[model samples]
Target chain A: MTIKAINVRNQLRGRIVEILTGPVLSEVDIETAGGIVTSVITTRSVTELNLQVGTEVLALIKATEVSIAKI
Target chain B: MTIKAINVRNQLRGRIVEILTGPVLSEVDIETAGGIVTSVITTRSVTELNLQVGTEVLALIKATEVSIAKI
Candidate 1:
């Protein structure tokens, strides 16, 4: 699938090591060479993507959404 | 700030623990209660956001960009 979002610059490649599915939300853990990139997505997307353990995926992140805090 | 993106469902709150700046892209490490949510963003955004270590920010992730792969 081709994503047209130009701000989607980060494409971290990793494997789906674990998935915690919920009714409204789902937590996916992607193990990369650097570290584990944990993403909380929707259960609907999980079902649509057919994501499971051992699945390889690219965690695309946009800089705009990555808000910074000073805590 | 209000983000117009309705699909931005996941909002992981974390502190900016580390940042690796480059010419174009910058890697930011956010430490959250759940885990570390790493984001690769443009250096410009990082500068605009004035991100620094110990800064607290929300990592907003859109489900669509969180692609899945079966490996």
Candidate 2:
């Protein structure tokens, strides 16, 4: 399925640098221009997306899920 | 309560530029060095945090909740 658009406001494009797979979830790290953006997705998604080291991907973050902290 | 630390991997420090409040949620626009990071958090959090224009904050995103998209 082709995703033409997504509601997620933050989209950081980069290449996969590492993958730490677990029983149910996997941590996929992407190296973007800003920095390394890490994403922990379901193991199923890792397999379904055929994600691997060097694969280009976008780290998507929903605005609703974002938390604000005073600093 | 003071939070010493959080598990969220991504944290962007910025100053609140705008805020659109609603009944339940609010869209907070923050200006950071990278760019403008927008967040839609609960209005209750807005009140509790005393968020307003020019408020300095960190936009936090958990790795577990970040989605990966191939590009």
**Number of the top TM-score candidate:** 2
Q: Worst 10-residue stretch by lDDT in candidate 2 chain B?
A: B29-38
lDDT to native, each model = 0.72, 0.88
For each candidate in turn, the TM-score is 0.50, 0.85
Best by DockQ: 2
True contacts kept of 2: 0.79
Residue ranges of candidate 2 with Cα displaced over 4 Å? none
Tens-digit per-residue lDDT, A19-41, candidate 2? 99999999999887657778999
**B10-37: candidate 2 lDDT, tens digit per residue:** 8878899999999999999988765677
Q: What are the interface RMSDs of all the models?
A: 5.9, 1.7
DockQ, all models:
0.23, 0.69
